[model samples]
Target: MAEDLVLDTAIRDWVLIPLSVVMVLIGILRYFVSKLMRSSPAPDAKMVKEGQVIIRARNLKSGANFIPPRSFRTRRLYYSNEENGLLHVPKGQGTNPQAQMFSDPNMAMDMMKKNLSMIIPQTLTFGFVNFFFSGFVAAKIPFPLTQRFRSMLQNGIDLSTVDVSYVSSRSWYFLNLFGLRGLFSLILGDENAIDDTQRMMQMGGLGFDASKSLSAEKDGLDIIQHEWALPRFEQRAESVLRKLVK
Candidate 1:
């Protein structure tokens, strides 16, 4: 019996302990890497001599999807006038390269593939860690206290920011064992989260109105000429300054 106990202890320390440590490390690394990728700045255009704008209608009619037309739409703003007390652009010359990307089926497919490739690995890595280490960490603690501690970790380190890449790992695990087992409902919930994040990021960082951008009238929205939102704003400011100087 003593010999058996000694062997069991050795196995626990050498095998189980090491495995547990490795798992925890992998999980943490996964989380940080995801954070890095998600937080990477969206492209900026100033370096490349570009401009960006989020179009707002001067007097968009009520209940209408304030957007531009498709075939007649032009990308770059090379026309100007006044209409109904606001700056009016009747017909414009030049075309926006960014705006043109959506109409190309091949380009759209390529973009989607690239995005999915970036998200999948980050998500899976996080999932693996959340599934394996979270439980292991919970083992030493009391039942009632485990959830509370886990919740603390999640809120403190997880969803408070934009890191939604590995949500299936952290958030879904808690949900599944915590009585949320309906697979269909869970999937729908994940989709909603993803959609929400995409919308929020586009609105806040890119100043993009996806709805308007997608409609029959696509030209109405201001074209983001160069890259990200910051440089676009900067470019506009510089243009205003130049006009003042001249």
Candidate 2:
């Protein structure tokens, strides 16, 4: 059996405390910088209307069973009608996202700004930690962790004998990077740009296709089998009333 290593208390005070504090401060700074760099362009009215139409269509599909058959059919027809439906995207109305980005200078600039804000700070922070605190054992977690957690928690340290619960400076930095999201959300609002995970996911995702969304919503509305529940509810209410009377 391997013996547990006793870590010096000063490591926590010098390396762990400062690293965490600096990470938090950097996150707050990044949030403010992102906010300042964000450009607020006036939204297109047609795009807004299209988004609302999709929302209304989705709501109708979700609550179809609750509404009367006549009302449900009317709402469904309003969205799914072949000739004049709101969800119908006319031919040639959809523009390629790449072309749209090329045509709109502001869109390209905004994307560049977002990329810069996410990348620059991350690079600088990683460099800073690597230069100053590389290979140092920052802190040991209170509970025992399995060997599977060794690669994740003990990133900078290469020794096989080290306990899996012991966190290296590099691993601690990563932990703080992802773990501060809730804290950032509390200090800034929910929509704040301090979250790196969301930024990465946004970079990975396909940009929204309005025409595709409208077509999908239309398809969803068409397939729903709307059965009015009022009569059933009334019957259940009568049964309950009869039991109460008995």
Candidate 3:
């Protein structure tokens, strides 16, 4: 194993400071790129009505217990009646459950735009770091790392004797890429032009077919166990009275 060597302060001036600055700038740029790429969805009257109806029915199922049974029956009849049930689909109304979701073009378009945003910055950064910041140990964390991270944290330099904790310039940039998010948020407000946390989360769900999301949501809604909240009022009052007396 190579002996440990102290890194110069010049590395801080030339590598660490510069890499940190550039990453923050790049994150802010990507934020705007994503903002410009995002297009607002068009309003769909039918879809809006469908959502409202579904919510109304679900709320009634779990919450309408306090309505007199006759009134509840009437309301349920209004929802379940063969002519105009809220939950029932009309014969020709987008019969394929996933049809609407699959046909929507916005998610695909947004995904492409976001991918471009991520790719451009990453590619540019790789080339930039290799060109200008190669062959120097940039920074070290407070803790130790194993041999596994040595290769990852030192891209251009190759030396068995070098400590794994001493990262190369490019490695420092990559580390700052993911690590300085909190600092970025502090510099640029929580919902500002530099935040990509939400964007990254959106990326995770991007692989899922939009249709599957709709199907999953429907499955979830279908199995909701509706326990009425009002039936235990009399027992509750007695218990409260007993507590007061005690």
Indicate which candidate wins on lDDT: 2
RMSD of each: 16.5, 3.2, 4.6
TM-score of 3: 0.70
On TM-score, who's better, 1 or 3? 3
Order of models, best TM-score first = 2, 3, 1
Q: What tens digits encode model 2's per-residue C-alpha lDDT throughout 180-245?
A: 888888888887743677777886553667888899998888888778988999999999999999
Tens digit per residue, CA lDDT, model 1, 1-246: 011111235544543454445444543453445445453334546312222222333223221232333211232232121332122323443345466566656555655554664466547755665555442222121122333344533432443332222222234334332332233235444422333246446434433333333232334434322232454667999999999999
lDDT (Cα atoms) of all candidates against the true structure? 0.38, 0.85, 0.69
Which has the better lDDT: candidate 1, or candidate 3? 3
Could you tell me which residue pairs clash in candidate 3? Answer: 2-161
| TM-scores vs. true structure, each candidate | 0.28, 0.81, 0.70
List the lowest-lDDT window of 10 residues for candidate 1.
135-144
Query: What is the C-alpha lDDT profile of model 3 across 1-246, one tens digit per residue?
Result: 457688899988988888788888887776666668767767668667666666776666666666666666666666655566555444555445345445767756766777777777789978987888888888766678889987798877887778788788878877887787777678767655334566678677544442333344344444544444566887899899999999
Error of 3 at 227 (Å): 3.7
Comparing 2 with 3 on TM-score, the higher-scoring candidate is: 2
Ranking by lDDT: 2, 3, 1
Count backbone clashes in candidate 3.
1
